[model samples]
Target: MNIQNPNRCFLGVSASVTGRSWADRLDARGAQTALAIAQRHGVPDLLARIVAGRGVALDEVPQYLDPSIRALMPDPDSLTDMGAAVDRLASAVLKGESVAVFGDYDVDGATSTALLVSLLRTAGLDPLFHIPDRIFEGYGPNVGAIEQLAARGVTLLVTVDCGTTSVETLAAARRLGLDVVVIDHHLPGDTLPEVTALVNANRQDDLSQLGHLCAAGVVFMTLVGLSRRLRDLGHWTADRPAPDLLQSLDLVALGTVADVVPLRGLNRAYVSKGLIALRRRQRLGLTALMDVARLDGPPRPCHLGFLLGPRINAGGRIGDAALGTRLLLTDDPMEAKRIAAELDRLNTERQEVERAVLEAAEAEALAATGLEDAGASIVVSGEGWHPGIVGLVAARLKERFNRPAFAIAFNGETGTGSARSIPGVDIGKAVHGAVEAGLLVKGGGHAMAAGLTVERRRLGDLRAYLEGQLAASVETARADRALAIDGALTAGGATVALVEQVAKAGPFGSGNPEP
Candidate 1:
């Protein structure tokens, strides 16, 4: 077998049907490393190239292929506020104080809320929880919700997958004499919120370098810290054992994959181990969901992301936002089955609404910038559109147009918008900037996705602002948007044995593409 030159395009196909070039994923150095990997490890040449193309170092191949939780799990206290957050949680447990969890409406939020609630219940505490309505309460904690919890005699509030930007809301909670602990992963605003402990890994001052984690991942680490603290305080005994944190990996895996974070480092280990737990089908709610989704075989990341995630998300999109959390937290099989069936029906309804919105949004996007060139970014707004369905529309538009996109649902004076960004573009930062510039009422998210609110009159102004701010970066990203091919394979060269060897690299997702 002869190796092609690394400088040349794979199979000499410069341009494909997608109007994109096909190029070697491996450079000269990477090609040499692949050859070395094949020679040293005695693996198939294609498998070696795939591993090398993903930027795995020569010595790291063994660990990369086998991502163990013990090897990849970091110390819980490594995060900036883990200790302080644990202290408050432990105190709540010791004093048997009333606690409440305020979570977002998405899968990440539901899982985070469920995970925390499960841990608290194990410690002999019955914690109250809330999943806000997407349209009514919007994202993150709101004023009225906090006041309601405080009225219920809640002494401590723990917000998951939210609260990083809820400065005023958490401050209000503080005013009601409630201690707030925020365990989140979203980027923060200019001024940090005044809370008991904000245990976000993505905070500006955090040096954990664990920013790739999703909200559920952050919650898991916080629980680890809290569990340790509880143990130190003699909260566990023979009669009352500590919660088996491993059992909750199923939730972590669901949120981690559904949120679409980069599957690298700790995330890789999480999904790898979490799949093992998920395969056991121990969680009644998930098992019911699996049955409804017709998932007969073992669960994988794709199953979680495409099947189960959509059903859970359907509740937040069109139905009751609390349905997902209720489904995940339920211990009764009958209740889980009922909620799962309702979610399945809701998902079908959501698909119809999403398709209608996507069709309208695509037409609007095309008319805004004809087929010749789809400008730097696209901003599409429609009257009377479902606000909950805009995120799905924005994602579809971004994929179809190959750039950043925002789908706005207008209702008279104001509009709710959801944004999806391309590789190099930072839509979250752009939203925050728009907020600071008074172009948007409020917005916040991570790099790949975001949500925003703006006055209907300022739609054009927001579009122009985004184009000017993101043009250079979008152009640079699109210029290099070639499809990366590790190696070309002939029909005769493909074999089952080769594929089996490639299976060494398991659980691929956003950052780790399947070969």
Candidate 2:
């Protein structure tokens, strides 16, 4: 395949000046030495040069390439409130208290819910799960859902991938005499909800070394903490096998990659180990998914992100997101195969809808600018646009324009929107600002992506607000778009041996991208 301008907008690096500075640094740092090591390891010289350009140290290569849980994982105790969360959950399990897991509908939420449910069941606890509908209930915990769960005899509620910004919902859960434990990765607001324990890597004052962990990774870490606590309390013994935390790494990897979280620190370990476990076909659901997707070999990050991720996301985006969680948690091969096939069909349908909506969104966006041509940032909204595919449309627009983009689905009186941003522009902050300005009913996300709900009347104002906030940053970001090659090399340098050696540095995604 032809590599299209690999240096253009290379991971949002500025090519003209900053890119040159990076190149100069690489040259001074003995780029040739790095290239030689790449060659010795049988990796492409171009990739090696890129790695050298990124200033990754020689000693760090092992950790980057051959990430091992034993070597790279941080202690669970390092997370704040982790001990308390584990203790609370252990008590619930021992007391046979019904626990409810409130999770988001996305891949991270689904996978995290699956991991926690599996872990609880392994410890002999029957855990109930609740995933809010993205279209109906929105992102996080809602008061209605909490009430329903509490009424169902749920004494403890554990929220994964969401609930950090859900102040009112959590407060309601507390009022219902339910203990709440929140394990999330989203950035928090000023006053956190009153909960039994809040465990999030993005907590303002959190000092956890694994800040890059996704929701599933956080859930895994919490399980580790719970296991340790149980061991200390003499509740677990060698005769009773400890919860196999490693078994959940596959879910962690799937979530981390699908959610597009940065793959650094503990995340690297999860993906590396998870990929190995996935390749071994330990999970019938994942194996069936691979078969449905026509993947003949072990699933890679690309396959997960492009093929499998979309299929899993389709459930949450269009159909029932619980389908994804069920697919991951099931043990029966035939059932897994059936679910995989359904997900595959849903993904195909999603793609078709997305294409039609994208065209309409693009037309609306061009018309809004009142020019035959528009600049980098594109924000557009239209009636009857499917909320499920708005995020994908935003992503496509961002790629085409090389700028921040937002696509909104207008349904007469109400609207839902998703935003994708160029590097250096914080889309989450923009969404937060809109919320603060009362332009949006609610919005939250990371720097690169965000979601929002707004009154149809506020569409114009929302667009203006985003444009004002993103204008300068978009220009700066676009002006700097250039591909900065790590180094130049002949095609002869691209070998299977080199790819394998470089593969060791992989499980690579956002943040710790593969060179």
Candidate 3:
């Protein structure tokens, strides 16, 4: 409401620079109409104006700000293959099969694994969990993981957050007679893997309108389906209490924010409910994490994104990602406290490493451009760079340059790279192209971020390839980096009441970001 940051560049509302000018213009038009409506309805002018500016229609006003899972959530049956996945998982639970959950190392993956593991155990299934090592297992389902699980007599493998792109790994699981149920949110390639059931909102044929959900959200939907199936099959009695989906929403909220997914529809509901659940302090690990992070109030989206998420991810980046997962899933308060403290320490260390990497990357970019003036896109690499922090550095470079960027850390033979991109350019496509050009050993991701492994000798080739691909995209992105405020406001509009009114349009992020 104050609308201006004195220390930062202030691009006025409807400025030509940022494409957000359209949002400002739309806000102005809505504000005009809102005034008329407010007078006619005898409503608060500020609330009406804020609601209008957020594109919340009169019909949606009641629900937009106050997210209700019952109203906003779509039936799990609408998701393709959800019924089959649920049936298979329910059958496995009834048969007392040994199940294993395979997940990635990021926050979303960790939370999803925790949620599924907890839910499955509640459903009477003894489930073991595995989170891939960032440096050793190298993201997603691996053949070695499948073999290890099989060796441990795991009959059914439930993969969360990853495994959509793991064709070979799934194939290995099949060869070992392990049935796999994949519940991921990553975009699937043309060829689908042979698995017991694949449940992902991002599948091209799946039109559930919840594709923006993160892995934890997907896992939540799976739980809903499984719970319903169990209820119908008499496996769960009505008086036994519901699965307590709300209790797990905290994890869903963390994953949704950390994965940078759009907070709309079901996602908004999850975050709204999850925030309340987080404040309840039910989960010992989460409570300890909040204490260590110095968060006293209810967890907000920014807290998950900026403060808590980074600390949880810090373990995966430089240390073991499973450490964060263990902390989130543990029941022992003392153990949770110890793990939270260690993660907090690791996060501090991670920050220092990120600072150093960013400085070196910026210097390298300036040198590459030859005039101490790099263009919109920044692509940098360094020998002995920390692999865990490359993604963080790429995000920083993207913010600094206002264009797509990549940062790679090379060891002797292998170079692990992470990338972040602007809205228009697809970083995933760039990673795919690098793979197609034989410049990368493996690469994949969504539009905004991606990861790849390259030979150290091909670092120059990777940089050149990205530069060529980003040439025109960078120009357009740089021209659109300016910020646009919704409208000019007086001190009256900056009150806590107005903040609350504006907040009704949240939980904002990615596609459904706050205006």
Candidate 4:
């Protein structure tokens, strides 16, 4: 595959510095191996090389090409604490106890909540849910919210895409006799919260390599496990068919892509299946969204990430916090259409807010020492910046700086910061460390992304701490940067069929970047 424009900016400075040149390399051995694998798979040499070059085994070519969920689906029981989570839910359903799904305000959070809510509703259980207001609640479950759910008679609280670090909140729920099952992918703090079941691939003791999964993916697996257990419990009566978890792939796929997790193995299956489901136009809310976005053709990964996800997220970000889940779960087309239109308007507003924050953050980023002049990283905090758009601003800074970036939005004495990191630097771990050191009020995340709550007074301390922690890793990652080209080819060999074959490697992002 042809590489895109090279010599991009590095930390707000132009990449084309005087004598600096991009380090591009072509692997002839890998190309030859691809050709042999292609021959074995009975495919075009060009396509074979690309897939093989990506480390796909020769025996797995067909399955990889097909991207079937069944081929990639692991036993749900493989995830740690999954059985406990499922059993708790089944107990609630069997006993006619009430449930509440608490989720974050992002796309993954919205979709994760919707998937669980939909599945429970189908299984003859009516569920209440809460999507925390972005500005008011920040992230993860809070003690007050848990108490309110308990007062409302919600016996079991299911937190998806959040709650891994909620020691205080989960403790409050436990004291009130409210059960909690946390099915989240975020890394845990010093200790996991006390709950009915904590299902996280990233938990310290969990050996599941599926930490790359988004929270929605984690929820989907929970449903899979729940189904297996419910099937054993004879809950799947003839009238009440087991919820087809496959039908939910559309939400799983959207959340996976939107969260920017690595699209490999199960993730690939989810997106492959989800893209098909999306194109079917079966979900009225999504169909309305596509109509509003003027998506005339097939829905690609780009459409999901940039188009549908943002609109859904806009509801949680600026408009109604629960609007995303409502849109995703509503069966009424008129209602879905109205919500979709409102979300569309909110997304436009999100864009304008994002642009303004980005411009201001960019200026601050360029002005920061070492950041503007080949510094290890970028950390910019501003007063009264919109918290809703800080994450987006941090993401833009990440692209421009080619390194980990933090954009903090200060509200009086406190600031809520969003961080985006490059591959090697573990911003989440850094944030977690800060939290442990009593520097941050709270923080947790994966390698690529994280969030933090810090005092305005501690901003400098946090910056100094991160710079010291990340300086070495940042240098190593930057030194490792290079352009990966498949190989050289003659003019006659380049054809549409060859391009189509390379296209088979994608739905690329994060772990499966375009090759």
Candidate 5:
């Protein structure tokens, strides 16, 4: 190993960013079944190898590559309370009762709300919807908003991408004589909220393994459940047929990619189907958004996540919280265009806000390396840091340090922030642990990301606890870290057809990384 550039991979291909070559450490023949698969399937050798390297079995290759909703969709009733949730929703739709759908302010939340809004309108029910202001209400439903919706003659309330953890808020709604259906994917807490139905794929007792589903996916399944239940009940006559779930896959795909859930299992099918739907551009809102984003081609996961998701989320970050939901739910092209332009401007503003936090957090991150106990995770805090962009800062720090990271912003009295984690380290559980330890005011999240609040005075304890908690896992993951190269190629050999072939292995994100 007398290599001059230890950082650069020299497998006759691209090297690691630090100029390191993990090629020698890579097991190129790891996908030994790929050759046989290629021979049997009559496909390119590289394609088979790429699929095998991604852990797709030979028997699973066809479905893995060409995911179909029919082949992969799970029974929604298999999830707890799914039937009850659908029944409740159907009753509201049929009776023409005033209904409100509440969602968080993120892209997942916005899309989830939009999906429900679209479905309800199609069913001839004009639904009332609410996307809480991130600055005022933070995440999940608050007490005041519930009361307002109730006062607006809302007989039923449906929560999308949120409300699983709002035990108290839903309880208050219960007292107000409001029927509530909770459709969320976040890991649920002990003693679920007392709603009309609590339908979550990630419910502690769920065996569906649909925990990988983003909120939009979960919401889409609920639509399927509701439609089937309605059809079974003869609610849908000849004129009013079932609302087509396929038409809404675009929303599901956008939220799925933007939320950064692993594109595996049903998620893979959803994205595959949704991408096709997106290409059709039947949705007026999506077409308007693509125009404003200047995307002159079929929308891809990258366009959804990086280009469009940011603009949708920009409203939640610095502008009106409901802008994204409105943009997605509207059928009017004029309204869509107006909102899209406004959101694009807001996204630029968000970049500026994110940069300020990134610069300050970068300084703190660099300064930490010199400390005696730098710990495994990056933790940075500063007064006057905008809570909106803390997650972006955490992601930046994590990328820079190749570890888990958290950025807390102090607003004199309280600190609210976000956390971003690497593959092996579960920052969601870490935040939950901190909250359980009474180190945080309240917090809950999934494997990779989370949000929390704390008393400004106890910030030091929260930091220390997270450091101690994640130190072992982070160190262990780093110690065992080894990049596996799928294959190698020369610059001249990388043709357009080859690029297309390689792309067949993707739709990759958090868990199912690009090969």
Candidate 6:
């Protein structure tokens, strides 16, 4: 709905059914910027306000509206350890050494693994890959997987979306004589792992402010460097040519969107350009997956995050962990169809499991809070709750209660938990602190989400510790939480033409919420 004054609250409702107040997204300065955008670009008032509400500057509007990888991509070498990581990877490629890629079971990890595997295969090396089982192996690199890779004549190990805090496991890999190259975007600990080159933007020492890039984005940059290094070494010839990096953007877009990373700056470019690549439907497995999901017309961010991504992740969550990577890497259309159907079936099963778990968790949360406002954080534990679905439950609880939440699936003395955080609260940092305090066995993640292992006996202690550590911040975040309405739209103003204009500011999710 369009309000004449941007400073006033829309409809002046103190609170809504969702327990949130409605407020104008733009203030005095933002309203002025919107006017400037409309005058400067000769665009609609609604479109200008949407862009300006997102904090886009007058000068930045052109690029923000039409993001291109070439325009937004930073120098690959700017990332810490990029040069060393590229050199080591190039050496392996030139020497035709056996390389193993380890990835998390999620969509980002699977796509990152597939991106590397495809490129390495183009370089004439059939890279071996491993996606850890969610139930059997949990998350990240494990000692057993590393030893097995090394035992199978692997010399170089590249881990994607994981291994940032897997100091012990990578140490075991080094002991087994594997040169580890970690390409992840997760937060790291004070003591970094001993590896050839650990390239993570979120690491404390990294100057690359591209912390918003997902693991697939990091892997894409690494490939950019590796490709350049190989070309410098005169690796491409008549018999072999450089792989088209643009083709891989589809993977980057899927991973970036599915991982729920912020779509801003470079990430915006990746998803914007990558969506074009995805629309071409050149990737066979994604084609089958699109058919299975009944995705009609051109695929959008919602299609990736809600439909295709879930199906791909279903394999890792409740079925065979390797199926996602396999689907992405396979050349046979028949195999692609097979894996896509299997993933679709598993996704259905996963939804049922998730529904049951969410019901149990919601009941516990309501009982604990006694129908009043939720505590600083909610921690709910139940026996026989599927660990694979706890993260989904945590996300639901976080959304429903508007507070940081953790859902634990206990099995006897041990419990596995997942957490989701609201804005202005850092779940990963809190989890790391709990781990250091000996309250958690192990845990790590980014700002919004995390996973951990805990003792059943210490669950209450963990709850108290988190509330104590996070209460003030949680209160502040919730206090500021409100629905930011860019502009009001009347029934007649909601035209097809108006909707098309809004699409220009798109690929919106996470940090870049839809206006």
The C-alpha stretches of model 3 lying farther than 4 A from their native spots are 1-58, 238-241, 370-376, 512-515
Per-residue accuracy of model 2 over 486-507 as CA lDDT, tens digit each: 5444599777876775565566
Clashes of 5: 7
The ten-residue window of minimal lDDT in model 1 covers 1-10
Worst 10 contiguous positions by lDDT, candidate 2:
1-10
Q: Per-candidate RMSD vs. true structure?
A: 2.4, 4.4, 4.0, 3.8, 3.2, 2.2
lDDT of 6 at 361: 91
Model 1, 3-25: lDDT tens digits are: 23335577777779976667888
TM-score, one value per model: 0.97, 0.90, 0.90, 0.93, 0.94, 0.97
lDDT of 5 at 73: 85
TM-score of 6: 0.97
Top candidate, metric lDDT: 6
Model 3, 65-164: lDDT tens per residue? 6888899888988887898899889999789889999988899999999998887878887799998888877888999878998999999999999888
Residue pairs in steric clash, candidate 3? none
What clash count goes with each model? 0, 12, 0, 2, 7, 3
User: Measured by TM-score, how close is model 3 to the native structure?
Assistant: 0.90
Candidate 4 versus truth, CA RMSD in Å, comes to: 3.8
Q: How much lDDT does each candidate structure score?
A: 0.90, 0.80, 0.81, 0.85, 0.84, 0.92
Lowest lDDT 10-residue stretch of candidate 6: 1-10
Better of 2 and 5 by lDDT: 5
Which candidate order results from sorting by lDDT in descending order?
6, 1, 4, 5, 3, 2
lDDT of 5 by residue, 90-158 (tens): 889889999999998999999999999888888889899999988788999898999999999999999
Clashes of 2: 12
**Model 6 lDDT, full chain set:** 0.92
